[model samples]
Target: MFMVGRESEAFKHCTPIPILGVACYAFGLHLLKTCGIMRSIARADLDFSYITSRLAVMSQPAEGLVESAYRNHAEDVRALLEGRHKGHYTVYNLSGRRSGALSLHSGDATHMSGGNVVDCPGWKSHRAPPLSALYTLCEVMYDFLEADPKNICIAQCMDGKASSATLVCAFLMFVNMFPRPEDAAQMFAVKRTPPGLQPSEM
Candidate 1:
């Protein structure tokens, strides 16, 4: 719900445009620009059951299905369903022989570099089916929330800006489901450091 980065006059000018194509580009740039501050937010969590049910419905085996099973310590498909594990789950190495289950940053960063003219070492990357996989991950997180709404779910990246954006997106989804400002405010609070960025960031 909160974000922070170096303020730039260019971003101030560019943010108001309504075009999707331009907006996506600007958003990425904005994240890159705001690489210093560790932005964070608190929200009404998620409905874990709803998410798990959705994933259950979309049960299709993919490359990391076995790894997923292993990560959950799921002896059987039913066990995987019944388990309470959730929140920022990861599937380890799928790129090569040394591959195992790793969180977003734990896997091989080298494989992700796709012919970039400039090599940026220590920068993490991975290929995720953004449309399908992101939605599925959201659903799973929702299920985790439904299981226990009082429990807080926190996600962050190494840089923190991208994680902040993702947290906002997730919070917006929850607000759509329960449309009450007071309810949301009570459920979640944007926790940003330096306290100056809270108003504009959320």
Candidate 2:
């Protein structure tokens, strides 16, 4: 629970803010800003489960559902639930060191775009990674979202910056139905200041 990019000074305005510099301080600030609790004695703890629950409460899907499936081989997954339209609990991991699953199901006919589902005819785009690669990732993402639309999807890389952001932005545009990659990027930037723009490797 490292507060990767929260500058300590950001919370200076909050009275009686913790000087301990713990990651939970950021969560407190967020809660204070959104929940409007001054003299904030009882701090709210936000772990993965808390976030997942909050999203469910707000009718928002969980994060990382899409990226998890994309990172693994599809056939390796063991779908906990299966439907003609989609499948769920798709667990897969090649190395056996760490295993993961997509918790949702979607109909087979639906194509994922921008963090949402769409039809083939409507899936139009000219971008890097090519359609084949994009479709494969979309299928994985769709499975997770379909299983539980309110589930959160998570992704990570060594740096936990651009690579993670790329996958997230991809899901935002492809499955979440975000209109533009730039829009997705801006959304991420709000949470964390992004590094300098770099040319796409592809």
Candidate 3:
């Protein structure tokens, strides 16, 4: 799942930015950054070596778990984008490839170009902005999740549980059309704590 929106004349400012928690894989994070869906990323300073070690002990291979996690993460993202979200959070998926190499250009004359590379089939060009509709919802999600209104924090991820919680809070806000950010956070806190948690002990 990719985050996308209509082409804006001015890039959206990173005020209340979306926080992508570390629970997401590097590839997913990288895609958001490359697509310009993210304004700010939350990278908490903490020792995760122990958790990594523990993950290695699981019965299933670590690589498989990682891949499964990434797929689930993408599904969650798609749910947010396609679900009945209020405000500007609601977005439709766009598929198909562009005729030529996709490029991103800034008014300052800075530009970048890239496309799918194939070894035998030759290179392929995809349509520009494969994803759209994430710009506004991202802003609102940030506003709701931020702890301090002054120092706005957009997106965040912590442990698997907490990160899922954060995503659901934002999802609730967007889908239900909560009027106030506080309401969204509060509702999640009281009624939806650790929202959407999968049973791991089983």
Candidate 4:
């Protein structure tokens, strides 16, 4: 009677329970992948050490400060460029004005080399010079992407999270329409924050 009871119990437990368990496991994985919260957590985990090291370098500015800063933060910048992390970043002004001039010249030369110079449309549509500057910057980034989509990731750092969010959204939209979302995601970290929250809230 005990053996008979044990056999019945085993038969009852073996049928739908395993199937339901497998289904539940698959569903949980799907939720995790689709929700993206875990991905963000993983990214933050991977970036924390590098970010802290960078912050430390930023604190010190005595003797070879520029070189030391670059040595410390160069990998972070590269990761950003490679789209492994999300943030707008630039090199610390290493050679001062000379470096700035060189970068400006390089950007200008790249634009001119395209051979399709167009006159700047008047800024009468916008009142502020900063607005005009913003337009110009957008045009430059668009042109750069048009010329070599694979080589560049454009980001701006005004209003911190809002600017980053806008840029990321635009990039994702463009990537979805023209090229590929996975490719764009690989090239730029998408900003993630709950809606209606300011950067300070984070």
Best by lDDT: 2
Work out the TM-score per prediction: 0.27, 0.37, 0.20, 0.31
Candidate 2 C-alpha lDDT tens digits along 1-70:
3222322233333232344344334323332222112112122221111111111101111225574433
Q: In model 3, what is the error at residue 69, expressed in angstroms?
A: 17
1-202 in candidate 3: lDDT tens per residue? 2233232222222112233433222212222222222211122221111111001000011123464443223333323323322222211111111211111111110111111111111111121111122334334333332322112111222222333233334443333324344544443444224234332210
Model 1, 61-83: lDDT tens digits are 22266645422222332223223
Better of 1 and 3 by lDDT: 1
Top-down lDDT ranking: 2, 1, 4, 3
Q: Would you give me the overall lDDT of model 3? A: 0.25
The better candidate by lDDT, 2 or 4, is: 2
Q: For candidate 2, what is the TM-score?
A: 0.37
Give lDDT per model, in order: 0.27, 0.32, 0.25, 0.27
Off by over 4 Å in 2: 1-131, 195-197
RMSD of each: 16.4, 14.8, 19.4, 17.8
